[model samples]
Target: MLRLHDSAQGRVVDVVPRVEGRFSMYVCGPTVDNVPHIGHGRFTLAWDVLRRWLTFGGLDVTYVSNVTDIDDKIIAAAARAGRPEVEVAAEYEAMWWEAMAGLGVLRPDHAPHATAYIGQMVAMIEVLLAAGHAYRIDDGVYFDTSSVPDYGLLAGQPLDSLRAGTRVEPNDQKRSPLDFALWKAAKPDEPRWDAPFGAGRPGWHTECVAMSLELLGENFDLHSGGQDLKFPHHENERAQAVALGKGFSRYWVHNGWVEVEGVKMSSSLNNFTSLTDLLARADQRAYRLLLLRAHYRAPIEVTPETVADAERALERLDAVARRFRLEPLDESIPVRRSDHPEIEAAGDDVRAFVAAVDDDLDTPRAVALLYDLATKANALADGGDTEAGHAAAHLLAVLAGSLGLFLRGTDATLDAASSALASARDEARRRGDFAEADRLRDELVTLGFVVEDTAAGTRIRRA
Candidate 1:
């Protein structure tokens, strides 16, 4: 059983899906008006890890992450670039996916874009208008916050309390200061869609309300996003769904922040570091490992010292793989963490690793458990406890794979000649021709490859 920190409950609770064995999850994807930043990377990796683990735990999962391809930001960027809004959206969206691929994020089961769902957005807004949950203004249609009594649920504040600090003043058309736009009427040179209310676009908040329900259905098992979205964005999205007399999400999960020099990295703050720049210079796996080495809910600081440390940790994982000639965990097939026969044979470590991650994704401890397993495997194999060492290595791989860390022996693949030489050396060792095996090993070492023999077989890695 996985216990996640449900933002709605403000406590850790077990995720019991309405339909047994199948989990429906919706994560708010990027509004790609610019290059991806470190914060974007963290949010994606956090939910990605959660999604991967759910499948790893043998649960059927339908994960839906959307793209806000048409937004105020995207429109603005397009205007600045002297291009069509769709072109700007498409360009950045491409960059977004390219960056996500570099970070090893799995593609969503369905990626519904806002532009494609304009019809659905209009229909949902009509339902709200008919239900008297929304009203139209000179600028556009606005959701009547007063209609939904419990509107600020995800924001963790009461409507009255939140409205007290509301900024929507001097707007006489709106009934209350807390009222938000459900649709924005077109301005000069901006995109527009026909709606009964007017020819305009859907507000940012309205986009997810329609997309999530239309794709995943009413009352999906989980709706997740970063902590920054818990406020007005998520709260407003929840309100629209509730106003239409539909259940939106059973659980709301929010991941923590990423910090730099002790301040939150955010575009609004103008302090975000680009994800592309970081990935270009640092090991992508190291960044993933760095995220995993911290409690998923804790703020992670990406300094040279931390990233260099994560790289060293990744080396240990690669060492185990090389020592055992371990086949890499394929990202395509996510199975139960202990499916490996060797891992199942190792008592308790698998269970302990699963427990740590299952407890609200306590990845810091989960990573520490992996290090412990790696240490045990290395020491046992060195001390001639081959069987136990194999089990520990398998356990480590299982845990790492659950978190999407596929450990490869090396990035360097051997050429045909080197492969043949390695095979000949294996044959020589089997024939008790130790002298010949040593000669081949030296040849490989001279070619910048590290070679080792285990009880299972000989392993090779690039030096």
Candidate 2:
């Protein structure tokens, strides 16, 4: 059994142990209009860590994320790029998958594309309309927020207040300002599909509700996304699900936004940083650490210095990973309840971290716990107790697997760096520059290599 922080209740709820231990989870994935940015990466990494811990805790986890291939933004982006909508969406979606895989995120069990589920979305909207939960506007279909009594519950906004604060372009067709679109009418030269209402496309919120229900049933385990999604997006999703007479998502999980120097990273502000840009400049593992440093709910203020710090920390962790004999740990170790106290404590910390995650996806606390474990294990290794060292090492391996951090293998780039260092040393030695050789060896250590001199030969290992 594990305690999960419930975003809906704003409290921790203990999930009862089931024989099958199946846990269904979903994260609101990207609208495949453009390549993802650092903000997008931060959310993905945070959830990847959470999923790792859940798997660590011995849950039969089935994770799903959606690819929103059809949206106003996607159409606009396609037009802006002078490409077909399908071509643009596919290109960006392919990039999203490649970038995520390179960043070491485990591919979700299911990745349903919105375009593929047009029939389901249309059917779902039809159900809502028949139930008196939606209304057809002039040229489009709009969800009637007034029909749902608890319209803004998830957003913590009352009905009238929500309507007042909400911004819908001064439109006379909408029954209320808070009412969001369910289907948008097709425009000239835009992608369109035949629907009962008209030839149109799915609204942004409609796909998730339809996809989640179709994939995970009316009720599922978890729903996660960026903090910005809580209002309008998630809130609208909840109302849609409720209107469809389904339980929707059980737990609402949200990771906080990435801030730059204390301001939210926004396209409007021109403060957004693309994922490709960051990956180009730094190692992927370093980028993960930068995100893991903060609680998921706490806004992270990223700068060049902070990213550099993350890169250095990753080097240290990579050194530790390289020292280990790469092997899968014994299946005997229970991810949730282990015989050893240390193991149990580690599991507890994970539970607490995720419970905080359950609270609102408190990723920073989970990150802190990870660093604590890494520090303790490293300290134990430093003490020269090889048995404890092995155990600690094993723990780190488990944590890495569970949290999707510290991939314990040789990256080709790192290997090339080692080869270059060796070549540099060899050149220095051939020049009879003993002083230069020593300096090069020292430099290799800073680059995460371990070097030792012996009577017969010199040995090198990743530091």
Candidate 3:
């Protein structure tokens, strides 16, 4: 059983306890107005890990994530670029796919775009209107919060307080301050689609509600996004579903924001860092490790120093994985690490690590536990304790797999960098620079190779 906290209910619940073989999950995707930042990378990778862990545990998972192609931001971007709406959305959406693939994110099972799901969004809004939960005002349709008695229940904000504290721009066409737009009327020279409410476009909050219902039905296993989305965005999403008089989601997972140098990362504050820019300076492995260094729920502070630390940490992890000739443990073996006394001593710590991961994905704690196991495993390997060494390697691989940090033996690509280094050494030796050649030979061996200057030739192994 997985314990997941429903942000709506503010309590943890068993997500798939009684389910048979399949699980459904929905995550809020990018809006496609701008390039994604390192903060978005954190949520994307974390959810990808969660999906992998559940699948590894023997559940068939069907994941659906939506792309919000039609939004005010997209409209603004189009105007700024002097381009058509579809052109702007298409360009940015392509960039999104490229960036995510570069970071090793598995494409979602169903990536429904808002423009593609306009019919569903319209139908859902029509249902809300027919159910007397929404009203079509002069030039727009707005969800009437008064109709839903449990308004603000999802976010735990009092309705009275929300009404008082809410700020509205000059052009908001709503009957009440608490009411939110379901569809906005078209403006001159703006991107517009013909909806039931004349020529207009779908509101931001309605896309996820409709897409989730269309793909996963009324209720799904999980709904995930950033912590900042909890208030108005997700809060309004739940209200739209409950207005249909049915359950929506069982669990809501929100990852905390990434901070920079002790301040919240934001474009307005000029403290933001783009993932693409960071990737230029660091490899994908190092970029991911920086985010995984902190727990998902805690605010992560990103700095050049922090990124450098993550690079060193990832190198250490790769060094250990390289040392072990890892193979998948047999399912029939019961995966018993307790029989070995060394592993038995580490059992409590291992259990704690798994528990933290299972308990809302405490990745930082799990990472610490992994480093501890690595130290013990290295010591055992040096002492020639095969049984204990194998046990430690097995446990470390399992934990590392949960973080998407392990390199399986089957998937090891030829190290082009290493091959290039060897060629460079051969060239140096041919040029009679014996001093440089000798330094390169030592460097190659230190990098997990058995470089031999013999009559036969140089060789490499699992050093």
Candidate 4:
């Protein structure tokens, strides 16, 4: 079984499934108003890793992440461009998927769009109104935070404290500063849906509550998002479920933020770095490796230096794969220690890796264990123990694949010019001409190849 840090509990706890041998999870998806940033990339990768690990453990996982096609941000962007809101949402949503595919994130089992669930959201709001959990002001229907006793449970604060810290808005008719709109009245020339309350659109927080309950049902196994959503967003989602006398998520998981120079990277702060730009310049796998090398709950600083370091680490893994002629492991297939003789032979290391990952998805520690396995495999191969080296390499590939890092046995075919440069560099080293050897190695690097020295000879691969 896996354990995770549940935001509602404020500590790590066992993730006991609602049903035997099955896991259901709902992660908040992008708003689709602009290009995704590093923060978006981090959250999506964190949950994707968890989902892959759960499946690798032989559990049936149903993942649902919703897209917010209708939001204030979408409307604002549309207005600025003099385009329809739907067109803007559709364009950005396509870019969102393109970026996710570049990062190798698997599509969710169900991606419920907010526009498609308007009827359900309206019905839910009507139920809340009839139950006195919501009230209608001139602007729109608002959820009364006072209706729920534990309104701030996800925020980990008392109601009084939250109210004190909240900034006052222009809606003076709101009963409390903490009260949030369930539906916002449509402004002139804005998109509107016909509701009994008025012609309006759903609030940013209402769509998730409606979609999750509809797709995963009550008390789904886990609800996850970035730490920023822990506040009024997730808390408000939970309150709606509680007010309706229904169960919400059994566990709440939030990944930490992406920080640049100690400040959180976010579009609102104008400090965000685009995910597309990073992918365009660096190897996409390097970003995933960078995320895995750090604890998911700790802030990560992503710069060219960090990405370059990850790329070098990836080169080492690929080198081991090439030396052993290892093939990529398919993570969709369930892995068991008893099924593979190599896994059983490498029992101690495999067990350590599992232990690290099982404890709240501690990927940093697990990644260190992987590097250790790679080193042991390479040393065994160099010591004339071919069989033992192959077994260790097999173990390394399987374990790394479970975390979604696939090692390739071969890179792009080395061109004739680059190959000759590598051979000449090896000859220079053999002749003890250090300066010439360094110069040739730099030349190969400039040709977009990573040059490495091995017991056999110089090994070159694409950078």
Candidate 5:
């Protein structure tokens, strides 16, 4: 069994699946109003690591992350650009997926879009209204937060305390400041959907409730997102389910924020870093390694220095791969350690890695364990323990692959020009031509390869 920090409970708890041998999870996805930033990348990677680890442990997992195609941000962006909201949403949504692909995030099994599920959201609002848990005002229908007894469960604050702390909105029609809009009345020149209550759009909080219930059903295994959503967004989602007397997510998980200079990265703050720009400058795999080095529930700083450090660490893993002539692990296929002879031989280290991950997805510790194993494998090979070294390298590859960080061995597909340089370099070394070997090494480096001297002669990989 795995454990995770459930935000609602305000502590780490066991993540017992609602069904045996399977898991169902929902994560709030991008609003698609603009390009994704480092914060978005961190949350997606955090959840992707969890999903991959569960699959590696032989559990069938269904992951649903919804896109908020219709939102205040999308509407504003469309109005400013003088385009249809749909067009604006579509453009940004494409960019969102492209960024995810660059970071190697697995696509959600069911990516429910807000526009496609408007009918369901309207239906849910109607039920809430009929049950006296919602009321229509001039602006739109509002969910009466007072109706839900434990409304602040996810926020971990009492209803009275939340009301006292919440800033009063100018909309005096609302019964309380805590009451959020369930549906927003359409304004002039804005997209509208005909509803019995009025012509309007669904509130941002309503979409996830409707889609998660429709797709994952009641009491799904987990509902996760960035820590920022734990407030009114996720709390409101839970409140609606409570009002309807439906079992919502069994566990609420939230990852920590991506920060810069100790401030949370956000577009509003204007301190955000573009995910696209980061990928362009560094190895894409370095971001995944960087996230893994920090606990999911801890803030991570994304500076040029940190990213470069991760890239250097990856070279260490690749160096071990080259030393043992290891092949890259294919992640499309599921690998079980019990089925692999090499992994079975290194049982202690494998068990340690699994134990670290199972305990609240302790990826930082798990990452350290892998680095230690990489060092051990290199040392063993240097000591002429060839068989021991191979087994250790195999273990490192499999463990890292399970976390979606695939290691590269030798570059067999180097272009002819690069291959010729490598061959020449090896020849120069064999003839005791130190100056010639040095010249050849510098030439390969200039050609964008990290050249290394190995027992099997010179090995080179892309920089």
Candidate 6:
């Protein structure tokens, strides 16, 4: 059985699925008001690693992540940009997907946008209000935290401790400081949805409650997001579930924060560097490698020195791939250990990788094992232990693929922008516009793409 750290249980526990022979997971997604940052990518890759591992292990998985398309942040950005809220959301959501694709993250099976589920959210709000779990105020409706006895289960604290830490709100109408909004009454020129209480929009906490239950049914297998959401955002979601007497997520998992320099990354810090900018300056795969180097729940710092180190480490892996002529492991291939007969002789390496990965996705140790296996593969081959050498190399590729690291057949990884430029330059060349083609190649070079023209076409990589 896979064991994971449960934020609600406050410990690593065996994963007992709500149903037999299946897996269900719900991860919180972006708000889509602005371009995603490295912090966003970190959370994204962390969950993507988990989803890939589950599927790689041959379990049928259903992944659901929600896009908060109509949040306060989106409304604010729309107002500032003088555009419709929906238009602002559509623009940034496009930016989000382009970034995710560049990082090779898989799309969720179901992406429930907040705007599409306003009706469901309103229905849930009605249930909460009918059961006396929520109350209306001058500005909006708020969830009464005291109604749920175990309100702080996912917060890793008792109700009193959770209440004590709440930032005092100027809205004194709230029953407790720990209480949160269920619906926000429309402000002037803000998007509004009609509800029994009034015309207002659903709160951030309510969307997941409705979408997860509707899509995954009650008592879904896992609910995960960044550690920052565990406190109020997720806690409020769980509270509503309990108040209405519904079975919620079985296990709660939250990844640690992404740090910049020595400090934690946050928009308030004015340091949410756009993921687009970071991908432009560095290899996209290097960021993925850097993420794999640390434990998912451990806070990781993103710095030039650290990223450069990760890039060098990837070069070592690529060198082995080039020497052995190894092909990239197909991600869709089954990850059964027995399928690879070569690894049967390399049992120790296989066992070591599985042992580390089984323990809360201990990727740091698992990645170290791959490095050690690659070294052994090269040395054994040079020493005439051909059978053992090839086995080690085969196991190394499989293990990295299991962790969603595709090491073979890669030049420098390219961002969406550079890749598009490479395509456009090819079209320019085909039209016999040599000047424009040269200009495009120069642009790619300035963005760190190694532009090469061949008899086939221009090849570009942004490592």
lDDT of all predictions? 0.87, 0.75, 0.76, 0.89, 0.91, 0.86
Q: What is candidate 5's local distance difference test score?
A: 0.91
Tens-digit per-residue lDDT, 125-186, candidate 2: 89888988889987689999998888777778789987677666758877888888899888
lDDT of 1 by residue, 352-420 (tens): 888898899988899998989889999998899987787778778877988888887755667888888
Per-residue lDDT tens digits for candidate 6, residues 265-317, read: 98768787888988888777888899999999999888888889998898788
Clash numbers, per candidate: 0, 11, 0, 0, 0, 0
- Give lDDT tens digits, candidate 4, residues 1-463: 6899999999999989999889999999999999988889999999999988888777889999999999899999999999999999999999899998888788999999999999999999999999999999988999999999998898888899988887877478999988999999988999999999999999989999999999999989999999999998999999999999989999999999898888888899988888899899888889889999998999999888898999889878877898998876654443444345558666688789989999999999999998898899989988999889988888988888788777887776888888888999899999999999999998988888877787789988886
Clashing pairs in 3: none
For each candidate in turn, the TM-score is 0.90, 0.84, 0.84, 0.92, 0.97, 0.87
Q: lDDT tens digits, residues 116-154, model 3?
A: 887888888889999888998876889988887878876
* Greater-TM-score candidate between 1 and 5: 5
- Provide the lowest-lDDT 10-residue window in model 2: 331-340
Better of 4 and 5 by lDDT: 5
Tens digits of per-residue lDDT for model 5 on 1-463? 6888989888889888999989999999999998899999999999999998888887899999999999899999999999999999999989899999898888899999999999999999999999999999998999999999999999999899998887766578888999999999999988899999999999999999999999999999999999889999999999999999999999999999889999888988989989999999998999999999999999999999999999999989987887888877775554554456667667689889999999999998999999999989988988999888888888999899888888877777689888888899899989999899999999999988888777778878887
| Candidate 1 positional error at 225, Å | 0.4
Best by TM-score: 5
Q: TM-score of predicted model 4?
A: 0.92
lDDT of 3 at 137: 81
| Model 5, TM vs. native | 0.97
